[model samples]
Target: MAGDGVRGQETAVLAGGPADGMRITVADRPAVLQVTRPCVVEVPFGDVRVDGLYVYRRDLRVDEEPLRYGFDPASP
Candidate 1:
């Protein structure tokens, strides 16, 4: 079980298999996704269903440098 301020509350349970790779059910939904590769699963806010699943492959490339973040002493 996990709680997120932006996502409200969510309970993720591994329906079967090991922790390394398995199907996870989010919010007790019927749709279960097998996490075999690197990807990002997006679900609608305050909803149990998965809105989208984006898979990251090796073919993808990053041509531009990512933005850097610096620590701010003023921020608590």
Candidate 2:
């Protein structure tokens, strides 16, 4: 699959390395898709198809505001 960025924020990570087995299987009889990873199974909404799959990881962090009112009065 071509490496494309979705929502201009998350990028798709093509299936490779040890995580290649990760896949989503759709059952035509029930109209559902199942995401499988090793020993875990997750059923997500929408039509289950290989063409709609894009995988990526996201990391978020929070930092303190320098102008906040808190202070350590006793510190030398």
Candidate 3:
């Protein structure tokens, strides 16, 4: 659900879990990340496909054009 006329924007690519491959619209890419959010999205996993909240956190690596996020299962 990308919007039009987004200023100084870059793609924040969500990795793993339900939001996998999901792109988030955000403000301009900064040299260092300041603002961030936790993944409260729930998804079905395992053989039972029971819905579980799979939190997401930023990957520790060099920042690229599109910011990448990985699953943070420990987050509550």
Could you tally the backbone clashes for each prediction? Answer: 0, 0, 0
lDDT agreement with native, every candidate: 0.29, 0.26, 0.59
Arranged by lDDT with the best first, the candidates are 3, 1, 2
Cα lDDT tens digits for candidate 1, 1-76 = 3554233223333322223223222332223233343334564556344422322111113222221122222322
User: Could you tell me every candidate's TM-score relative to the true structure?
Assistant: 0.21, 0.14, 0.49
Per-residue lDDT of model 2, residues 1-76, tens digit only: 2464222222222134233434332121121122234432276547553332323221122122111111122322
Query: Number of the top candidate by lDDT?
Result: 3
**Which TM-score value belongs to model 3?**
0.49
Q: Cα-based RMSD of the predictions, in order?
A: 19.7, 19.4, 10.0
Residue-level lDDT of model 3, residues 1-76, one tens digit each, is 2585445766777777667788876575433322234444466445444244556676648376577777565665
Error of 3 at 2 (Å): 26
Candidate 2 deviates by what RMSD?
Answer: 19.4
Whichever of 2 and 3 has more TM-score, that candidate is: 3
